[model samples]
Target: MLDGQSFLISRAVPGSCEQESKWIYMTQHLLESSSNKRPPSQESEEQEQGDRGKRKKSPECPDTPDITDTEHALDLSDRQGSDGDYDDANSFINPLGRDITISCLLRCSRSDYGVIASLNQSFRSLIRSGVLYKLRRQMGITEHWVYFSCNVLEWEAYDPYRGRWIAIPKMPPNECFMCSDKESLAVGTELLVFGKEVTSHIVLRYSMLTNSWSPGIVMNSPRCLFGSASLGEKAIIAGGTDAQGTILSSAELYNSETQTWETLPAMNRARKLCSGVFMDGKFYVIGGMASNTEVLTCGEEYDLNRRSWTVIPNMSAGLNGASGAPPLVAVVNNELYAADYAEKEVRKYDKENNAWITLGKLPERSVSMNGWGLAFRACGERLIVIGGPRGSMGGTIELNSWIPNEGPPEWNIIASKQSGSFVYNCAVMGC
Candidate 1:
């Protein structure tokens, strides 16, 4: 046998084996149900037992924090002496480097995220940075997900590719969660659930990457039943009711980069409980109940380049007397779609002839709980509709996905769940 001095370098740099062993343990844990953590696999148990009798102490990483924080990457790199140790604390290594690794993770489906997110802190930090999402655009990984909160406050997301449902982290607990039919907006890497605190008006944002909720920058005015839309990194909210429950015409823009809100010129017509949609690089505020008895059909357009708002003509004759919350509208490939609560059908906006085309009716037993029951969300270039047709107060609801590009649309029932089935709000991320 070689002497200690001669075999020093061959002993394997300190705790390399331990690091490899831990990675295997965590990966096994990842494959288990997210609702419960599982023990290491039998292979890992056997490996641990075999090594137990021959175990020998190795040099420990000095000043080595748990590596749970973002700064740990730098710490590990520096400790490894120029060339970092081969033991990457992260899950997988991309031969191309960290950028490629991030892009790969971003390209993964949302259902995969839950498993990956449970793997390690480094993975979480990279995802939360929103850098991967930007890379996704460059790589054209635009698989979208439809997320909605139903009878329960917690949100659930549907993955079109997988044709399944996965639970998202719960919103931060609040005594009184103020949610409107269209209050949820997905901007940048985060989803903002706008509402008023029990005692005051406040907004809460849930970050998908971090898997935690954080207080969002408050709006200039506290409003309920507002029109909201997201344009990737930025979001806008306009024309709702202010504190004390007064109707509002004010509008504001949110910049995720600055984490602040900026006031925009108010709309020409005051609208309460209106719906907003982003189409053709413009924001449109559609029909809303102007008063207890009157519903406003007039709509307005915000031209970001012009920094101006122009009043558009009233909607097609069908929505002339639209009541309650604004119609449930979603934009897919620059075309606008509105869900008709009365007819339970989706209508496509025809710009050329200025008419609404009846696409198809939603699945039977959908609940138009709040006029916005047909929570419509744009998934990539397709559409995901949530809610069943006029079901019993407490019953099951279906999540349907439709691809407009595929000629006439057909509903693919992706999931069914038990609830009072009243969906207060829904949003789509990873677009």
Candidate 2:
């Protein structure tokens, strides 16, 4: 049986501040006491100079992301494209007939993006142009779907808003990327499954726009049991064992837009069964093994712009080798929170104090499970925890969720299942 090291989770895409301004814009309006707009003179418009200079301008909204397409790409064996999903003729006019309104409505049912894209050329144009997603941001509308991957080539999704399990396409094939030791996450509206094909590495992409599964671009190195995370519209892959089971220190960055993988400098130490995360505009590759039972107690942080890695303090406790899963870590309000398996509690790391402080306990059954296939994922504004005993051995599964933004967060049992997979990976696909 795979040990606790095998349980390392492929992390989620860390949220960015790019959309925070938009969310604030809407929330501020909602808090207003009057319906009518304030007089221009009294408004806090940065363009309109105030007594105190430019009224301390708010951050500018980020530019819309782009997806590139190639008409003939057989030269590339593992690439797929949807002609209209991102085309400019996108979205039906909303009730208010405002493009932003239309974008919000479209975002709510992203499962219907492909169906709607086929409805008309106008919708195709809008969807393809990336403007619809841009509008969704402007409106501060977010929709996320939790996707689960079980061992027997089974895949299922849970829609939190609809409160039900949603059907998804079956797992593709064994010849493709394998997730035995895996990483999965959503980038924009697509779920990117990152793993290696035994020894050959590759990424399998499932598009919410196309409602289809297809081969992804490529990976610089095909190593399984590695750590992965999403940051700034790309996936960062760090230390893991290669085909021959060689622990590796090399890393790379995958950009979906250009369908390219740019190799980054190697980390300070070789690691297998490690975890990577995107926090505070940088990528941090955490604990893992460099040799048999030779645990790397500390970690290294990568600066995206500087292309460098800085070692941080060692973790209070490393993932339990016998637990069979990665220690879960989450980012809330730019602070790092991790599951301290050794202590059977959830703790947050204080970089300044260099200490781990307990926040809460693991779910009742979680601690005893040895972390087999356990998952703690960031979904929209909350975290979703899923897993249980290795299903092949037979037992029920659990789903728990929490919105850390709410003070003194509480966990809610989202659901349970009599039959569940020995989870390989889980990610949140969102608009």
Q: Judging by TM-score against the true structure, name the best candidate.
A: 1
lDDT of 2 by residue, 1-431 (tens): 00001011111223443443453444333223112221111211111111221112223333323322311221222211365232222222322222443423332334334433443444443445444554444333445667787654666777665455655666587744443555676665567776666446666787654456788776677676677776434778888777688888999887654657899999988887777777777888877777877767777899989999888757625654632455567664456777665566777787887777767876656534456566776665566677655445676667787766425447788777765535667776555
Instruction: Give the alpha carbon lDDT tens digit for every residue of 1-431 in model 1.
Output: 00011011112133332342343344344334222322221111000101112222223211122223433333343221233333453433423344434433443444455455444444444444555555444433455666788754587766555555655666766656634322778877677877766546777787665666788878888777888888766888998877677788889999875688899998988877677888888988887766666788677899998888988776634452434446778887788887777777888998777678988776566667446556777776566777874445666768877767535568887677776466777888753
Which pairs clash in model 1? 365-388, 365-389, 366-388, 366-389, 366-390, 367-388
Off by over 4 Å in 2: 1-115, 124-131, 134-141, 175-180, 195-199, 322-324, 367-369, 388-394, 405-409
lDDT per model vs. reference? 0.62, 0.58
Of the candidates shown, which would achieve the greatest lDDT relative to the real structure? 1
TM-scores for every predicted model: 0.74, 0.71
